[model samples]
Target: MHEINWLPFWLTIKLASITTFLLLLIGILLSYYLAYNRHKINTIIEALLSLPLVLPPTVLGFYLLILFNKQGLIGTLWYKIFNKQLVFHFEGLVVASVIYSLPMMVHPLTAGFRSVPKNLIEASFTLGKSRLETLIRVILPNMKASILTGIVLSFAHTVGEFGVAVMVGGNIEGETRVVSIAIYSAVESMDYKTAHIYALILFFMSFLTLLALYFLNKKWKPYDKA
Candidate 1:
């Protein structure tokens, strides 16, 4: 029997954490714009953003690989500035994760924003509050459930990412060897015991995450403290 290496699990958690944080920030701004604006172009933009949800992970990962390869445009610029390659690096994994998990975060935030009372937003504006202030003080406070849902979904999605992470970041140990990849490697090596253990852990983690989300949604009233 072989002792399990816990590094991959830690790496997966780190990736998920970073991905969720970036997606939250990006999701907020994008969701806010999409929620309030009415324009033909916005529809096109929304569709592009949502493509990840339906696109195959490998397809998205392949595009990212091309875009961030040593000779690729973005890759070249990053290499010139950072003096290192993006492919097969931890940073590349983060970028890939943000893109892959974007819709998970944005969809919920957009729904939350739209669910807010339009009159409440107008009143905040009429009271001389800035859009930013209104968003922080009013809109966000009322959209707790949506925000929570987005964060959880993005985190969970990033944790389970395999095809995209492998294609963009490769399975470099201690860099991009996330738990999902670890499980695959174990299976390939005929280490069924290790793979089973990893799979069980992931199953429990995902289950608990979703269970907590549902529980919180049931208990966390948006205006309870307001």
Candidate 2:
């Protein structure tokens, strides 16, 4: 048997961890904002955010390329201001993955936030809690399962993300090359054994994450009902 490259595996975990953490914060904030607002801009932003779900990864990556190219608007501004290039790097990968997996994170968070009872929100306000306090103490506490679900979903989605990462991050070893990209390279080289190994790891990790979610939700069933 060929020896496994633990580097890609560890890098995948790190990328997923960072991406999931940022996505969790952004997803929860977006969900909360969407839940409380009925504005037309919210609808438009929500539609745009969810657009990644239906769009092909290659297409999305192409647009990101244009958007982050040295001559591109955002890229030029970033470089002029901070002397940084945005493409073919870890930062670019994170941006791509976050955009790609946003819907998976946002959908679950929105569902969870919406599930918070109106009575609890009202009660918190009646008890003289501010809006921010009510969200932190009342709504978020009630939707803990959903929040956890969103985090797990975001992390898993990001770990398995390939096309966007490859197109934008360019498979730089020990930098932007995640497990998914490693698996792809293995297959490209006709290394089925190594590919299988990486694929199996991803499959097992995803399965276990979902299994934990299932049991966690079941354990929280009574609280959900109450």
Candidate 3:
């Protein structure tokens, strides 16, 4: 048995978890905006959010690299605030992962928000509930499948990220060397055994996560059905 340094795997999971959590929070408001409000500018906003789905990872990562550099807008502001550079750091990976995985969370959540009935929302308002209360007490509870789908997809997508992670985080050990980067490093060193282990773990883990999602949705929908 080749002794595996599990730090990369641990780091990858941590990144994915953090990204998914942040996306969930952001997606709730963003998805609500996209789903309920129709305006010319909303189209532009959604397009920007969805760009990562079509943009090449290296292209997106390159731009993010520049943006996260110490001289870049976000990076400069961050450096002055915390005295830390975002590039080639774990923080960089989180930011990159969030951007790269945005559509995965947002699209599903937007769909879920739209799936909610308009009357139900209005009724909540008529009953004197605020929008926030309706969202919390009504809409979200009804869209369990969409929420789970977004969470799983974002988490899975973040796990498999390679180009963005490499470009932004630079494969630093224990800090930014996620499983995908670790697999590439292992293969490059002719360490096929290590690479195979990581690959198989990812494959099975992703597969199982998806499988559980579908199963839960299938069983959940009938119960959640109005």
What is the TM-score of each predicted model, taking all chains together? 0.96, 0.94, 0.97
> Per-residue CA lDDT of candidate 2, range 76-124, in tens?
8878887878788787788888899999899988988888888989999
Q: How does model 3 score by TM-score?
A: 0.97
Give candidate 3's error at residue 35 in angstroms. Answer: 0.6
Give per-model CA RMSD.
1.7, 1.5, 1.1
Q: Tell me, by TM-score, which candidate is best.
A: 3
Per-residue alpha-carbon lDDT of model 3 for 1-226, expressed as tens digits?
Answer: 5798899999999999999999999999999999999999998998999999999999999999999998899999989998999999999899999999999999999999888889999999999999999999999999999999999999999999999999999989999999999999999999999999999999999999999999989977853456
Query: Each candidate: what lDDT?
Result: 0.94, 0.87, 0.94
Task: Please give the TM-score that candidate 1 achieves against the real structure.
Answer: 0.96
- TM-score ranking of the models: 3, 1, 2
lDDT of 2: 0.87
Give per-residue CA lDDT, model 1, range 13-79, as digits (tens). 9999999999999999999999999999998989999999999999999999999999998899999
What's the number of clashes in each of the models? 0, 0, 0
lDDT, residue 185, candidate 1:
96
